[model samples]
Target: MIEVHQFACLSDNYGYLVHDRASGETVCIDTPDAEACLAAARARGWTITQVWNTHWHPDHAGGNLAVKAATGCTITAPAGDSARIEGIDRTVDGGDTVTIGALTAEVIAVGGHTLGHVAYHLPEAGIAFVGDALFALGCGRMFEGTPEQFWASLARLKALPPETRIHCAHEYTQSNARFAVHADPDNAALAAYAAEVTERRSIGLPTVPMPLDRELACNPFLRADDPALQARWGCGDAVATFAALRAAKDGFR
Candidate 1:
């Protein structure tokens, strides 16, 4: 079986370490804080062997070199963002596959947070390590990709099995819930979800690995194609609605 260890790093980023029990191989899913990641692995008695980067963003890939220096881990990064990323042993794009021990993860192109951003989906494990592309109740800011591109990327994620567990990078759910409620006020599912998020936050709980099905039903960004959201946002299509929502979120607070 494969085991995942999720820990808080930096200020709000969540770091992940994927370990394959049979082969004792471990993979770091983005290096937010090098020391934290290294120490986490050391404490678990697991030696890191690979680093999988999602994008070129400093917070996501900044610690690659240090982690490599500490573990001699092979680094795999997205080809589109390879120019800016460091210590990349292999640069893969969408449709490619990477492995750890016996488990294989499909590299999904989920750009839009950044033009080169990618996500790692381990179908066999029913989980995806999505950087900032898709969040619990929100999506990442449209940093470098077109709205059409972003919506298309989100569509790819939507196509995944509903039961897939989405592991996003940040602890932004509480804030996102507020925006989600404002974005789709009439959604009962979203309202219920927001209430649950509030309760979770009140108790200081982490809400990173959200179920995709719940996100599908509640996240306004993911529901941009729904007719009600299109009408409410005054958009004609998914791309337009997504663009409007992203813009609204940019100025929401």
Candidate 2:
């Protein structure tokens, strides 16, 4: 069986360590904080053998060198953003596949947050480690991609099986819920989800690793293609609706 260790680090970032029990090989999803990641792995008696980077953002890849120095783990990063990233032993594109012991992970091109942003999907494990490209109820800001490009990237994620567990990189669910409710006020599912998020946050809990099916039903960003959202946002197409919703979220608070 495959095990995933999730913990909070660097203010709002959530770090992940994926361990394959049979092989005793561990993969660090990203290096938000090198020390935190190393300690977390140590606590579990797991040694990180690989680091898979989703993007080139500082917070996402900043600790690459340190982690490599400590573990001598091979680093795999997005090919498009390789120029800005450090300690990359291999650069992979959207269709490439990476392995951790016996587990195989498909590298998905989800480049809305950054032109080189990628997601790792282990279909057999039914889990996806999405960096900043996606969130529980929201998505990363359009730092370097266009609406068309971003929407297309989201479509790829949407195509995944509903049962897949979405492991996002941040603890921004509560803040995202506020904007989600405002974006799609009439969605009862969304309203209930927001209330649940509020309750979860009130007790200092993390709201990541959300179910993809729940997100499909409640996340306004994911529902940008739905007729209701398109009509409400006054946009005819998914790309435009996504753009409008993203713009509104930028100024929501």
Candidate 3:
């Protein structure tokens, strides 16, 4: 079995620890805070042996040095922007396979948030650690990539199996749900999910690790291809619909 532990860091960011029970191999996916990751590992009595980076963003890879110094863990990161990342012992790209004991994940080039952004997918485990490419009810802002590029990246992820549990890197679900409700007002799934998100956040619970299928039904960004929605939003096609939605969300409260 694969065990995962999630914790908060640097305000809204999240850090993750993955453990493969069969081989007792533990890995940390992106290091928002090395201290938080180390502490989480210590609490579980698990020793981290590897660190897998999804991108070169400072918030995600900033703790690489500290984590390596403390755990002596090997670091594998994206080769797309290796020049920007530090302490990467091994670099991989889209379609490359990485391992955690017996489990393997394919590195998906999900570049939109960053040129080197990647997503780790363990198909057998029915889970993925998508950095900033796809969010719960939203997608990442078009910072370093084009709207069309971001749309393409999102389309790849949206096609994944429905049951795939997405482990994104932030706690932006509440805000995303709000934007979703506004963008896709007639979507029953979005409305219900917004209510649920409101309740969960009211009590201080994390709203991550969401199922992909639910997001497909509720997330406005994912519905850009729907002909009805496209007409409603005054978009000519999926790409244009995506741009309109992203632009709207950028200025949304």
Q: Which window of ten consecutive residues has the lowest lDDT sum in model 1? A: 199-208
Report the alpha-carbon TM-score of model 3 versus the true structure: 0.98
* Predicted candidate 3 versus true structure: per-residue lDDT over 130-181, tens digit per residue: 9888888888888888778888888889888999999999999989988888
Which clashing pairs does model 2 show?
none
lDDT of each: 0.95, 0.94, 0.90
- Per-residue lDDT of candidate 2, residues 1-253 (tens digit): 8999999999999999999999999999989999999999999999999999999988899999999999999999999999999999999989999998888999999998999999999999999999999999999999999999999999999999999999999999988999998999999998999998889899988888999999999988889999989999899989999999999999999
TM agreement with the true structure for every prediction:
0.99, 0.99, 0.98
Model 3 off-target regions past 4 Å? none
Best candidate per lDDT, number?
A: 1
TM-score computed on alpha carbons, candidate 2: 0.99
| Stronger candidate by TM-score (1 vs 3) | 1
Q: Tens digits of per-residue lDDT for model 1 on 41-119?
A: 9999999999999999988999999999999999999999999999999999999999999889999999998998999
